[model samples]
Target chain A: MEKRYDIVEIKENVLADNDRVAGKIREELRRSNTCFINLMASPGAGKTSLLIKTIEALKDKYSIGVMEADADGDVDAKTISALGVRTLQIHTGGLCHMDADMTFRGLKELGFEDLDLIFLENVGNLVCPAEFDVGAALQVMILSVPEGDDKPLKYPLMFKVSDCMIVNKIDAEAVFDFDYEACVERARALNPEIRPFRLSALKGENVDEWIRYLDGFIREWRK
Target chain B: MHEMGIVLHIAKTLNETAEEEKITKIGSVTLQVGEVSGIITDLFVDCWNYFKVRNEILKDSELKLETLPAVTFCGDCEKTYPTVKYGRECPYCGSYETWLLTGNECIIKEIEAETL
Candidate 1:
């Protein structure tokens, strides 16, 4: 006896649906004249600290909204809310990353109608968050000095995809043996157009330059 | 790490497709994962194994992954080369004007199931 089984040809990209949703969210944000930035990094990369500093610098000039996504807990969201910005905490319920649909839902909950800029503090995993677009106009990743310079080689995809690479914890450069020049070179090799800024989010070292760049970026984005 | 989330999504999609097609049991799922898709096949299969036990539709389903090679296309030379080997630079013409044509995909290509 011969057995038979049906082979269904799906040919569907699992991320394609998420990409479509992300594209729609991008168009929606564009129509609303809002600049969306997706901030990604490994845990303890000073993402929240950098966001606080950014909000402190830009809050007076532009209406800001924050979406803090984590596997669980609202620590970052609480911290951002204390800065007086409209902040929404999205608990990913154990998911390591936020996809486009998740981001769309977060935007709906945050309500970016009257806001000029929105920042999505993506779940702190360098690998997963970089894979999802999340409708961000710019994708930025922070690499602390402790993470070492070989990160660009180990995690090439994250560096290759990011529009901007922020090297946080520059103040700790004296303590850690981080090769700043080599890191920048490796990142540039992966993505020539990648704009890298070395700053210490905690000590406020060179943060003004980051704020300046962002000021111009937001202004140009809103134009 | 996010492979668990991806597994959940795949299981959900398979369940829905099975329901639509009147499939009672899923024997196996052939997933075509690109070399540059950033998904660790070992971790992905492990996550699938863990998730399948909880999902009735995928309880006994076997997860098979097929690796698709990463390929890049050079605009200047109009040539394609292995992305993992040559990266952004075209191997043939040594041109930097190259874009990835394939090998960033996490797709479900085929599904084998039993009818009700």
Candidate 2:
């Protein structure tokens, strides 16, 4: 039997479609003057705590909104709401990461207008969240002191994709033997353009530096 | 479930392509997965089989996998080496100032299809 089969030469990246949607969302966010920050971290890595600290520091300066993407929990939403910040919790339905479409839906529900900053505290997993481009203006990932300083070596992609790396739980550095210099060295080796910050969200130490940097970042992004 | 998520994305891309090209049945899908792309091929294949049965256009389709070896470039020595073997530190120069040149890609190279 003679049959014809066409070869479709589609040399496209798997995330190309996702990246296009992400680009659309980024442009739309820029038009609305909203800085969308995608915050990623492993479980118990102080993502929420850092967000709380940053929010508390910059809440008065900026009209902030938060989109919390947990697997299935509203506890963080409730906590953020207690600060009088508008927040929405997205249940990932057991998905490990948030794609561009999921981020779009969350941003739509949260409403980006009249808000200077919106943070998508992405599903707590370093590996998957770093893989998807979720249309964030700034991608921030945290490596807690207790998690050790060698994380950047193990999770190279997460470190590479992130625009900023927050070495959270600096207060626990003494107890955990986290070498800040070595950690930054590892991260810089992978991504020299990455901006690193050291902060202890729980003790409110060095959170000011992170806040000031973010404040400038949001303003600069709008400009 | 990372592979499962990737499978969903692949399914979405396939459906969009099918619509654009008017492909009635997809004969096969070929993917170029990099060594450092972190996709477990066995798990990915398992997920593809599990999901394709639910998709009308993809039910009869088989996935063809290809490997893209990871390579890294050393800034100090200006030499390239296998990423999977040497990792971040450049084996040639023993320098920490190294960057990946390839092997982190997940791409759809081509598809064999039949049109109505």
Candidate 3:
């Protein structure tokens, strides 16, 4: 008699389903000529501030939309909508990260059709958001100066996976005892191809440079 | 905290696999978790134990998790070593030009089921 183990070898990729759904979302966005960005950061890293400033700067040139994904509340949504841009709030029901399906649903709620850009503000988390792809053309991470320089070493995946790193709160660099150069160096050591920007969204210092860069990308995406 | 969601995902995948394999009951599930995946094994296990109780098909199923060590490769030295023991800096070449090779997976490697 042969001994049979109940163990069945099933080698399905864990992220395969997510990637497939993300592919479909990407295809839809491409067809509609809507460039999507997935913004991630720790809580109070200035992601929403950046979005608000970016929208105010480019409101004349582009039709922009914003989607805020968090576990609860629609405060961010209200702020964005007050700027006269279409916005949607998605409460993930205590989920830490925003996946592709949630983003697609948020897009539907926002009536994403022929929009120039869609900004999906992921939940304020460093680790979970890095693991989930929300079908974004670019993954942008904001790192505040007050978050400490050692953040890059501790949370490598977020920096490694992000396409751009926005070093926010530049105006508070002096008061926060933050080393901006070291942060960029460490982040570059992790991902050399990552685009780094230094700006203070509140004071509007070097923000237009970011707006110009993003506007250029949007223009190229449209063409 | 988010391990509950992952457990749900595991349950969904297991149910689909059980249906396809024509298995009546699931006995066990073995997972290979990477050290660098940022997942908490204890939390997942706890969530799995509680979450599975609600589903009739997976009420008695067991979850076994095996942790994988982090391995990385250095481009300059052309050497592979443990990423956790040594930082991003290569031990042999002292170069930071290293890429992660393993230890980032959260995969269900095997599922044990019985067919009546």
Candidate 4:
């Protein structure tokens, strides 16, 4: 006769464990008054360019650190380090995304105590990064003009998870058949509260507005 | 790879649960995966099978996946419909203002285990 095993109710999201770790990281960051932003987007979506612009714009006011999470590369870290900010490159060892545990390790290495703002430039992927929460108080994602406006429909979860959306490469909008309004509308449909910023990171267009908003957000979060 | 990541997380959570509940061996795990959760069941099971060998507590454990139906609610009509059948647009009202009400979930509903 087969014995029935005791069924222990474990009604928890699979990501709950990760979320716990993420919550801990967020609390630690809170004590230090550090604003953590998980910046995500598809590869070549100008995450690095925007980071440089944001850092340059805010570097004078706040001490900034960046934990660049890439599957493999120090190129972005080197570029950001050129601006003289504390930039740490996190190699995911071929993983598609960085989980909360990996994020905690990065923060420990980067030392969040002295920093006012830390940007985890998450792996350049749309799908995987959205699935995992890295304990950021704010989540920012980019959608380049070249990537098309239909991206929001294809990757709804990415837009849904993101708190802010940056429509980068607007300088190339003339060449590309990308409609900014349509893109924002699609993303807004998924996430009614998702704030969208249309800018060209390469051309330094409208980046100031984004930075100002971020500054205000950091101020609010720290308060 | 995404399935592998999820499995890893599941393993992590199960281990924690095992520790907390004092479970020596897990007989089976029942998961409530939604249709639009974006998780491929076959890949998830394959990953689970591949992962169980390393985790002693999960040795020979059966993975039971119960799919939760994906449902979308139309903002215009205020009626729910099958998400897989109708998609984002409402069939009855022909409105684009439809949002997912259910699905897009991966929850560990229950776990059968041997306690000490």
lDDT of each: 0.90, 0.91, 0.87, 0.94
**DockQ, prediction 3:** 0.55
| Displacement of the residue B79 alpha carbon in candidate 3, Å | 2.0
lDDT of 1 by residue, B1-116 (tens): 87887886677678778889998878789999999888889988888888898987779788888999999988998988999988777889888778888998889999888887
For candidate 3, list the clashing residue pairs, or say none.
Answer: none
Backbone clashes in model 4, listed as residue pairs: none
Regions of model 2 farther than 4 Å from truth: A1-4
Ranking by TM-score: 2, 4, 3, 1
In model 4, the Cα lDDT at residue B85 comes to 90
Can you write out model 4's per-residue Cα lDDT over A1-223, one digit (the tens) per residue? Answer: 8756899999999999899999999889989999999999999999999999999999999999999999897999999999999989999998889999999999999989999999999999999999998999999999999999999999999999999999999999999999889998899888999999999999998988999999999989988
Candidate order, lDDT descending: 4, 2, 1, 3
For the second chain of model 1, what is the TM-score against the true structure's chain B?
0.94
Error of 2 at A169 (Å): 1.8
- Rank list by DockQ: 4, 2, 1, 3
Q: Per-residue lDDT of B66-100 in model 2, one digit per residue for the tens?
A: 99999999889999999999877888778978888
Q: How many steric clashes between backbone atoms does each model show?
A: 0, 0, 0, 0
B37-104 per-residue lDDT for model 3 (tens digits): 77888888888888888987788787888898999999998999999899689999899888889998
Residue A98 miss distance in model 4 (angstroms): 1.6
Q: Output the number of the DockQ-best candidate.
A: 4
| Clash pairs for candidate 1 | none
DockQ scores of all models, one per candidate:
0.62, 0.78, 0.55, 0.79
